[model samples]
Target: DQQVKQNSPSLSVQEGRISILNCDYTNSMFDYFLWYKKYPAEGPTFLISISSIKDKNEDGRFTVFLNKSAKHLSLHIVPSQPGDSAVYFCAARGYTGKLIFGQGTTLQVKP
Candidate 1:
């Protein structure tokens, strides 16, 4: 079974708006959650993360929320820009440092 999943295949947003991306997971063992941004022909780069003990984390325009009881998580990007267009991936890391990723969501920021 896929431990993590992104239900939306893609999202489109106008520049300077807020873009929301969501994710769900089946495994409670995952203690660390992270979001990554990927461009074509390149590897995914870390965007933001939250620990299991924390409910929310933020960094500049990126924020991540974790709901352990609901087994769900989401990423928010404020003032979305054309440069933000990319595949967003949600990932969870367990005790072993092994990461499980959700199916990516492609974000198209139209300027």
Candidate 2:
């Protein structure tokens, strides 16, 4: 059961605030983790990634932290803006470039 879980279906935050998204996984074999941000119709764009060997990875306003022992990961965005409002998906790379994704979380940024 390689199921990645994003418990919250959506989140809302005021602009200039911090936005945090959570994800959990049952499979321990997943070694590569990624976070993707998706707009309305376009496909998800890679935002940040962390390998199982690392505990955290960051890129600009985005940061991802992984706790291998708990099989949990989180994405954090600071000073959230309207542009950051979109669907975020947590994925883990499997054998064949097949990524197991969570249901996704929609973040709404208020002006």
Which prediction has the highest lDDT against the true structure?
1
lDDT of 2 by residue, 57-106 (tens): 88888999999889999999998999999999999876566689999999
lDDT of 1 at 27: 90
- The 10-residue segment of model 1 with minimum total lDDT is 94-103
TM-score each candidate. 0.98, 0.94
Question: What is the C-alpha local distance difference test score of each model?
Answer: 0.97, 0.92
Question: In the order shown, what is each candidate's alpha-carbon RMSD?
Answer: 0.6, 1.3
Residue 69 in model 1: lDDT? 97
lDDT of each residue in 1-110, candidate 1, tens digit only: 99999999999999999999999999999999999999999999999999999999999999999999999999999989999999999999999889999999999999
Residue 12, candidate 1: alpha-carbon lDDT? 99
Q: What is the lDDT of residue 66 in candidate 2?
A: 97
